[model samples]
Target: MKKILLIALIGYGGWQFYQKQSVAQPVTEPTVQVLPDYTVPLQKAREAASLLQFRCDGRQHCSQMKSYDEAVFFLRNCPDTKMDGDNDGIPCERQFNKG
Candidate 1:
C-alpha cells in the first residue's frame, strides 16, 4: 500500500509539473528607440537655427507633450527634460502609455 501511495504521489507531482510547463505566458517588452536632437524651425530666409530646449523644471513638461515623439525630442536635446521618471531611457510613461 505504501508503494502504491508513493507512486501515485509521484505521478500527481509529474502531472502538475507538466501542466505548469504547458501553460503559455505572454512576453512583453517596451521597444527602446534612439532618437536625435532636433532644432527649432526657422521662419525666415537664412534664419539662424536654434536647438530645441525646454526647462522641464516646473509642471513637468512630459505630461504637456503632445506625443511620445515630442517627449523623446525634449528628453534627448534638453538638459532639463525630466520625462523619464524611472530613468529607463524611455520617457513620458503616463502620456505615452498611460502608466
Candidate 2:
C-alpha cells in the first residue's frame, strides 16, 4: 500500500513538472504585415485625396465654397449645386477667375 502511494506521488510530481515546463515556454510576438514601399505613398496619397478630403453634404451654392476646386467637386459630384450658372462645366467663375 505504501509503495503504491509513493508511486502515485511520484507520478503526480512528474506530471506537475511536465505541466510547469510546458507552461514556461518563451512567448513570441506576432509578425507584422508591411505594405510595399511604392504602394505606401500611393495609399497615403489616395487617403489624403479622398478619405480626408472633400465630401458632398447638401451644400449647393458657390458662396458656400472655399475654393474653386471645392466648388468644382461639389458641382460635379453633389446634386443640385448652383455654382455653374451656364452649364459650361466650370464652377464658381466669379469666386475663382482665370487671369
Candidate 3:
C-alpha cells in the first residue's frame, strides 16, 4: 500500500511537471500600421483657439503650442482647451503661466 501511494504521488507530480512544460507561451509582436503624418492647419488652430476664447499673446497665444501636430491633438481631444493645456485633468488656464 505504501509503495502504491508513493508511485501514485510521483506519477501525479510528473504529470503536473509535464503539463507545465507543454504549455505554450504567448507570442507578442509590435503592431505595424501605416499612419499619415498629421498636422493641424494654422487656420483650424486659430479657429479652435478663438472658439475657446484663447488670446494669442505677441506671436502666439499659448506657449503649449509646440507644433501643429500637438495642436491638432489638443483641439481634437481636449474638451476645454482654454482651461486644459497638458490635457492631464488640470485646466489650461491654471497650467499656463500667463493664465
Candidate 4:
C-alpha cells in the first residue's frame, strides 16, 4: 500500500511539473513602413506654369512666333493660325521640330 501511494505521489508531482513547463509565453509583432504617393509628374507642373505666360492672340502663322512653345500655345488657343501645314497636332514642324 505504501509503495502504491509513493508511486502515485511521484506521478502527480511529475504531471504538475510538466503542466507548468508546457505553458506558452507571450509573442511580439514586427514593425511595418508606409510610403507617400506621387500621382503627377514634375515636367507637367512646370509646363502648366509656363503656359500661364501665353494667351489667345489674333496673330497667325509661325513667322510671328518667337519660340516653339509660343507657336504651340497660339495653335491650340488662338483661331485662324496657319502653323500646322500638315493638319497634324504638332505646329511648325519645319520651323520648331528638332527631330
Candidate 5:
C-alpha cells in the first residue's frame, strides 16, 4: 500500500510540472517595417545637396530645401563660388570642402 501511494504521488507531481511548463510559454507575433513620410524624389534631391557641397551656412536656408534642389540653387546662383575645391567644374565632388 505504501509503495503504491508513493508511485501515485510521484506521477501526479510530474504531471503538474508538465502542465505548468506548457502554460507558461507563449506564442510571439512577427514585426512589421514602416516607410518614412517623405517622397522618393525628395529623398533623391537631398542626396544631390550633399554632392553639391551645399552647407547650412548658419542661416538654415538650405535646411528647408531638398538636397538636389539646394545643389541646383547653389550652382545656378553662386557659380563664382568656389564649391569645387579641386576646380574640377563639378561643384560638389569628393574634393570639395564644406567650410
Candidate 6:
C-alpha cells in the first residue's frame, strides 16, 4: 500500500511540475514595429498615389526633397522615389543621411 501511495505521489508531483513549467513559459505574440504619427499622413497619401502610375520624372525624385520630412513622405508614399537603393524604407543616403 505504501509503494502504491509513493507512486501516486510521484505522479502527482510530476503533473504539478509540468503544469508550473507550462505556465511559467511565456506565450509570445509576433512583434510589430509602430511608426510615428507623422507617418500616418504618408500612409494615406500612399493610398491615393497608388491609383496613379509612377514614373521617374527625375524632376520630382526623392533626391530633390528640400527637407527630411519631404523625403520621408516621398519614400513612404511614392513608389518611384529611386532614392532607396537598398530597398530600405529610407531614401537618399547621400542627401538625407538616413533611409
Alpha-carbon TM-score of each model against the true structure: 0.37, 0.51, 0.29, 0.52, 0.27, 0.36
What is the number of residue pairs that collide in model 3?
A: 5
Model 3 / residue 87 / CA error / Å: 57
Error of 4 at 34 (Å): 22
**1-99, model 6: which lDDT tens digit per residue?**
999999999999999999988886678999999977664588678755654534234434654767666665566666556667787767667786773
Model 6, TM vs. native: 0.36
User: Candidate 5: where is the Cα deviation over 4 Å?
Assistant: 27-99
**Per-residue error at 46 for model 5, in Å?**
23
Q: Between prediction 2 and prediction 3, which has the larger lDDT?
A: 2
Considering every candidate listed, which one attains the maximal TM-score? 4
Candidate with better lDDT, 1 vs 2? 2
Instruction: Indicate the worst ten consecutive residues by lDDT in candidate 4.
Output: 90-99
Arranged by lDDT, best first: 4, 2, 1, 6, 3, 5
lDDT of 2 by residue, 1-99 (tens): 999999999999999999988886678999999977765687578656863479999999988999877886787788888888888999988889932
Model 4 per-residue lDDT at 38? 63
The lDDT values for all models are: 0.69, 0.83, 0.60, 0.84, 0.57, 0.67
For model 4, what is the alpha-carbon lDDT of residue 7? 100
Going through the candidates in the order shown, the clash numbers are 0, 0, 5, 0, 3, 2
Question: Between which residue pairs do clashes occur in model 2?
Answer: none
Model 6 scores what on Cα lDDT? 0.67
lDDT tens digits, residue span 32-58, model 3: 999999999999988776557543332
Candidate 3 residue pairs in backbone clash: 56-61, 83-91, 83-92, 84-92, 85-92
By TM-score, the candidates rank as 4, 2, 1, 6, 3, 5
